[model samples]
Target: MARPDSQLLPLGDFKPSDEWQTHVNAIFYGIKGPEIHHHFQTYVSRDYRLAHALADTFLEEVRKQRLADDTITIQEWGVGNGNLAARFLSRLKSVDAAVYSHIHYTLCDYSEEILNGVRVNPNLQEHEGRYFLKQVNAETQDDFEPHSVHKIISNEIWDDLATSVLLQNNGMLYEEFLQPLLQRNIPNVPWESFVEQFAGKDLDALKKNPPFLEQIVWERSFQRIDISDWPYGTFILKHLDRLADEIPIPINTGAFQTLERAKQLLAENNLGYTSFDYGMLSDHELNLPGRPYYKLYGGQYTSMVNFPLIAEVGKAIGFADVQLEHQHDFVGRNLSENVLSALELVQVHPRISRMEPWDADLLMLQTLQALNASYRSPYKGQMDYPPMPGTPKKQRKQITELARNLSATGVPDTVAYITESEVAESTGRLKKLGYGERDLKNAFDRSTQPIAFGHMTLR
Candidate 1:
């Protein structure tokens, strides 16, 4: 639904300053800095499944280590308001008390203000002495010594980092740099010029003036960029090698750097790291493309990760094993049988209303969690109003309602492969991971509510 405002006038008059990361950094790390919770709350939902997967990854690592430090340490990059941390800690507690007690969860974010804001979260608060709030950069673990942490996890952090927006026309490549349309939000041409243009018009008006926008005007800046010169030209050839079509994909340079940093930050052979971002896992997936969707929202920018590239970079970083899979596959692999069974039941009554059609599966999973926990179906009287020990009121209402219309004969056949979008790959990647097609489908149906999402992990 969103596209750049760049008008295609002849490339004749275009200026040169190809720097998408700068404006992106300026907006996210500067202007609205560390105000990440605000961005996610408006655009995405709380992903409980993802948090569970992350916790499971770390917990498994801790168990394998057998408490080397007697305390496991993990530093999550870009913890924002720490809702994910709260959910992770809560789930970790429920699954294993010993693991939960030993976790030294470090909430890292570059914004100190946001770091301070997360300290008060009741979910994170319950796990007292098990948390640390630190202001740090995801791309650089300069503060920590090598092999200092057990796991490095970031959800959607890579997309926020700087990226190069390149374009391919004919055999040549061009970079898309940004220059703020100073006139769009500025009263005059530029800030300094604005005051001169307005002169002495009410000095007090400046204080209550309409908020300024850090709106970026995308300009094709091809100056001094000769792709035919050695590494620069080699970069073009590198992308050319990967091109299914001559689409200019974003070179997610930040993801490469981040992985490099993560490799260094990880314990020698401990849980490497896991980063979940909406991305493409294979160049074949990029076979049809207008450069996978990137969006600009509220002055913040996000683009689908190039997972295959990330994996390749991980390999280049000397990581022996790099795995890339769909988000559902990653989260589904760790899902309990109860949650999986509940996933199947939701679709049994396929007509259930969900706030987001895509999230129908997850919403259903959340709604039926009581059933998963208590071993009761919606039709059972126990899962009702003024609910018994296992069934809470929320589960009673939602589950009871489903039970009324439920029919054993109507359960959906979820195993058949379903490509959620025109561009989604049709291959059964999860099947290779030892998952049943139907259950994989259910997991995908529940979680792929957001746009195309992929998971990349290296250990």
Candidate 2:
């Protein structure tokens, strides 16, 4: 808990946003460790479908390319809870034992805390001999030999890496900078003492105390800056020249570094690098006014992945082919059907837009109930949907009943996707909830957003 509100004290001088982002994330992941999942959600955090889809795609690629080597090397960076790796291996083994026999999977993360935590997950235990864990900071890790890894995949990691925000006014480009300040009072500890502990890297001592990172407040300022010396500066500048002025554009510099590293690490007969993240997919969306460039979750800075820039970076780094599309589209390609996220399907309901928050929650649960019939997930145990605060006692009880009866096999939460056939199976139940067949048909259609889930693959 925070201490009595007090005057904010400057934690440090203003620094470039990317530098500050990297600094804060380094500290956040260092301390939060395994508990980081509580602050943010990733598609693979609880769902098995995405992992299975990726496994299928990789297997198809393996068959087509048919690498001569006896062993297949696949590395997943920024793995969360080891679920994706576990599910992927499970799918591979169940699908084809021969390919699974040659698979050598590696989990890479910057936090030893996270690595240690993933090491003990019961789900990963079944794939004991097939996987290894390595601590790697994406921005500057080079221990792996060039052309060694056959496949590299990451989910929701690029957003946490270093990104710089630029806004052009009257042809003058300005970069965002931020100064960190701490809350005046923090329980029993003095502010200065907190700073001393933070500077000394006494993470263990800090961990035993109240959350210090939560007390941070950002002070933003902008200044003209030079990027001539930065990596891919010329390429980034050329792209920025084509974009409109007065709109802040995020450049994921760290993502560019990761792409470069991926190019170096992937084998000549590789399946290549693929990452799933949330961000803008087109230049038109990036040029829109009032688009958010970054957000903070549990005091960790996360910037949008900037998919368009990433594509350019991938090509500039010598990847032969680069593809960017909606994440559901990527999953759909493997399933041979159109797909929609649970939230997207919920939004397509005819009466949803007119419903109140409580009513909307009810509708969502009903929708999930309808989808649950044939949407059985192979892996379960991550279902928890609490009713909204201020829900009436009767409605709360109704929600509880629905949640209790919700199948362990139900379509997973908002981020998980369901195929068209699954929606077809639920059509009768959905019609009672006022959804028409066309609504179900159009449920497969996804509209582009200023910001949305995106998948990028570089080959």
Candidate 3:
């Protein structure tokens, strides 16, 4: 977890652990078989206002347009589980009757399994012919007709798209090329069946010219990223000649490509689109502490969007208005104030918390984040629990004594040396101390302040 400039250990110092991400994620995401959504659920927010926000904005555009035959075509890109589509369609029906009646709402996804869920959904089923299911790849959007759709929207999807891991060293950029290491001559070989899909291609050689995965021109290895190729090349060099510092960036080329494709697919008459993804608004936050800009979730790769680039690209593509804002601000402006106030009240009050399962999960995550900041390594008491302000003193004393025992008896070495069994034992002790399931989880959970949601619109 050291900074980019920490040290150097010649080339090919250490090969990375076997992982499936980026374009390789296609293997796991039902491109071969079994849709990814069947196992991995990303649509945790069903009844939330952000879902309504996207639908509401789409409706706004629908209302603004001059209708010819009193109809409009709206499509959603990368429709995973179709919860958002069902939710949005239901919300649209309740909000605007005029737009909902003449709407051709299409759910676009690459996986037939995913689109099947959309077809069976009770909420979407109510819409009937108005709702069409289209199996299309977001990368090429091959099935879609340009200037045929009125509005396009995606939620938490751009990150799931193909991305390029990059690095900056000595004022130049390089792409991180990943080579999947497969076990050879081993019992119950991992990915044996999947690797068999590629005819006449060695696993090692596939790293350079992958059939499914993407690899840039020049590759350099450091930590998990390999950065050697610079797409900008002489262009970037000329620009850097007038600049001060060369910022290290993990560019999401796939997202940029998607945006460019969206521009083509959108109608020429004030085509409107909204993309809501968790990303960084500035380069300064790229390498900051407590910032997980890039993360691996459920074996799929996701990276923080360089939102400014989206806006600039949108402007270049003749978008009359391109705006980027935090999700909190966008949601606040569109949603009722009472909803946010109620959430804040619940956070401050000790009474009943009406948060859903996802909210509770968020709370525990916040607590653990705070705990990380409070205590350093070698302290075995570094466990996740409820905040002290909310818990009673008796329970607090029990936790303190448990911490003392862990610090004394547990590994006297660093955090890395701490065993999984030791941590599990500490968790068991917390349960015995009479802390409820939710309370135990709340100990270190701080508010989601550091976690900022990025919202961008192209119109």
Top lDDT model: 2
Which whole-number lDDT from 0 to 100 does residue 124 have in model 3? 63
Summed backbone clashes in each candidate are 2, 0, 15
Relative to the true structure, how large is the alpha-carbon lDDT of every model? Answer: 0.56, 0.85, 0.52
Candidate 3 — which residues are off by over 4 angstroms? 1-20, 31-45, 182-194, 198-248, 287-290, 338-451
TM-score of 3: 0.62
Please write out the lDDT profile of model 3 over residues 129-171, one tens digit for every residue: 6788888887667577778877787877777776555455565
Candidate 1 TM-score versus the reference? 0.66
Candidate 3, poorest ten consecutive residues by summed lDDT: 412-421
How many backbone overlaps does candidate 3 show? 15
lDDT of 2 at 231: 81
Ranking according to lDDT, highest score first: 2, 1, 3
Error of 2 at 253 (Å): 0.9
Clashing pairs in 2: none
The whole-model C-alpha lDDT of candidate 3 against the native structure comes to 0.52
